[model samples]
Target: MECAGYIDGAFVKGEGARFDVLDPSDESVVAQVTGVSAAQADAAIGAARRAFDSGAWSGLTMKARAAAMTRFGEAMRKRADWLSACAVKEAGCPVSSTVMGAQVHAPLRMTDEIVDLFLRLPEQEANPLPMHERVNPHFAVQSLKRWSPLGVVSAISAYNVPFYTAFWKVVPALMAGDTVILRPNPLTPLSSMIFAEAAVEAGLPPGVMNVIVEPGLAGGLAMTTDPRVDMVSFTGSCAVGASVAAQAAPTLKRLVLELGGKSAQIYLPDAVGRAASAALSVCTSHAGQGCVLGTRVFVPQERKAEVLEGMAALLATVRIGPAGDPATQLGPVISAAQRDRCAHFTRAAVEAGGRVVCGGKRPEGLDQGFYWEPTVLDLPDNSNPAAQEEIFGPVVGVIGYRDLDHAVEMANDSRFGLSGWVHGADRVKALEVGLKIRSGAVNVNGAVMSSYASGGGIKMSGLGRERGIDGLREFQMVTTLTIGG
Candidate 1:
């Protein structure tokens, strides 16, 4: 596939600069995408700004915006297969995983759901308390009000699940009556470009949505710090998130950051076997690239032995191979650099006295590609770097806890509070632990993750929320109107 940047409702060849998209399965160049110049970035942002100022989108009635978004959702569903294929090749994600991530099932559902939510916004309601009632009672009850859009949004998404993350930002922003400047991760830009094409085909205004493919901090900074951008929504590492925050502070641009995670999966003694098996499945899924993968597993000390055995056994069964393989459960890490990073984290864990129960080395026979076998480590304590840091590959750390209180303590020890999982035979006991755990969202007994409820994090996990009504509110500001009787 040949790919380029999308701007002003069209795909155009970028400046002479170009980069190769490597197939992580074979370490071969899968595609080449032209690097967008600063001028191109400026043009895209300017177009988005113009689109916002002209009110082609913002001027539309709420119903009209919802209708356009619904059409965009349908177009996405029509091209889901091509988008999934692009995601698989560009990001080295398993075809099965890519189908779930980029195949528009969730995106389409989310778009429709959000449109419904948008149409039901509180703005349309009449003031709840009548002026005559207020005058007679001599008491005033505040009326509920809704938020309005913050204008053009600059959405910077990561490479892990390019289209999924991009849609999380773009759908909500556009639905809220804002234009967008989208910058997808250079490693997986094609899927996002295809999404942009679908949006334009669905009748999005010419400059309302634009995409630029440039691989570096410069492009991101230009988008984030641009004065024309009314808001900046980003998903990536905490380090970069901090940088973006600092740059946006001066302008006070509304910012939403969905950053890193060191999520915990706690297993009670009763469910140790089941929890360990589930953790193994999640960690190996998508080569453990998901931000919410329960990389940190906390188990009762008494059951640690049995849990480790089950985890290792489960890890051994994961089928790692090329992304295109139908039977593959795990694929190579996104790139050579990512593979080495996972390796470094593994070696560091071993050096820190952690025990490697399974997969401490690269898989045999797969000499090429950025493949690393799914790894499970028994860490000495929660302080180990491998346990505290966000290793964006297939590495899981098992930490033994003395009891329920200790388990809760261990889970809340991290700076990150993204997501957590609790497993036990007693659902009530698990709920108690779940409430104590300081994370944005908690799963009890492998409950499904919802885009509306599953959000960003607290503390170092970055600010604001994504998904659901809360996610949509991040792109808006409140207004108040007081009338004289």
Candidate 2:
């Protein structure tokens, strides 16, 4: 199939270069995508601007907008199967772990919640202040604060989980009365195309939402640097995120960035016994491509050997194959480039006195696809590159700490603080240790990312929050109105 960029409410073929969307499982051409030129990107941004300024979408009542979003989501749900297949083929996400979870279900669920939350919000609230007799002695004066859309938003998504990430940014921006220009990563543009189709089917205003597919960063850069775009919600690497921030700085664009992480999973003294099983989660969850996965593991010095042994045994048993196999527990990485990157990190770590406990090379008999063995490295200290960097592959480095304080120190020593994990027998102790870790979200025991709260990062992990009430508010600007009669 040939995919075209959706611009100004039309599925327009790009005047720029064309590229093939490869199926990571076998390197087959799943689809050929035609990319938009700079002019096409400008048109997308212009459309969003016109849509926002015209109030074709933003002028609607809150309830009416919510209804529109609900319809959009329903349109998406109807194509769940196709979307899932496209994601598995293009991104190499496992149907068992990712396609069923984040790919198809979770995003739809988040859309419903965002619409509900948007409708529940108060459009305006009364503000109380003490009367200033010197300034204006009007006792009958009334002050009101209102939250409105920030205007045109450019929502850029990452390839790992493209659809959900884009949906996370787009739905809230729309609910807040903003028109949007969505740019999906070049590697995974299928879902984004479907999103555009759904918007049209849902009867969104002509320029309310737009999608642009490009082989390079030109189109995305246009969306970021363009003055018409009021906000940019980005999800990708830290380096690219920094660039996005810099590009958008001239316009002072509102940004919500979800970037990279070298997060830690700490096993308290008592929890060491349960650590190995839960640690295997990194290997199974889409080959640890997730930014929030705890690739750095901190365990008590006394129990480090036992944890590594159990982890190595479990790693030996993981079934590595293509994403389509129901029996396959571990799928290939997104591409050969990603697999090579993983190998490079593993080799570098080994050169730096790190011992490979189980896997450090490509798996056997799966030479065609980009598959890496579920690797576990026993590191001498937290200073190793494997322990410090974001590999974005199925690799974990285990480091031993002297005590709880030592664990906390090692975990917080990194430059990226996106997320963390804490496990212990004592709930109070686990919660306390979790609170001490300098990350945005911490999972106590087996807790996972929930829909009810906000999640983002601190330090180099990037700025702002995503999901929850705080995320919905990110798309809005506040105004205070003072009236006197």
TM-score of decoy 1 = 0.94
TM-score for model 2?
A: 0.97
Per-residue lDDT over 1-485 for candidate 1, one digit per residue giving the tens place of the 0 to 100 score = 35466788777787736788888888888787777888888988888989888888888888998889888888887877887777678877787764354334676567788888878767534457766754555555455454677798999998888888899899889999898888888787778776677677788988898888876656778888889888999999999899999999988999899999999999888877676675567665678888888899998887787788887888778888998888888898888889999889999998998988889789999999999988888898998989999999889898999998998998999999888899989989988889999988788886564555648788888899988778878887777644443
lDDT of 2 by residue, 1-485 (tens): 45457777887888888899888888888888678888898999998899899988898998898888889888888988998897789888887774358876888777788888878888798886765721365546678899988899999999898888898888888889999899988888888877788889888988888988888988888888989889999999999999999999999999999999998999988888887875578988888889999899999988899999999988888989888888888898888899999999999999999999998899889878889999999998999999888999999999999999999999999999999999999999999999999998888887555456889999989899998888889999999988776
* Model 2: residues with Cα > 4 Å off, grouped in runs: 131-139
**Model 1 lDDT on a 0 to 1 scale:** 0.82
lDDT of 2 at 178: 93
Cα RMSD (Å) per model? 2.5, 1.6
- Which residue segments of model 1 deviate by more than 4 Å? 1-3, 97-104, 124-146
Check candidate 1 and list the clashing pairs.
none
> Which is the leading candidate under lDDT?
2
lDDT of 2 at 371: 91
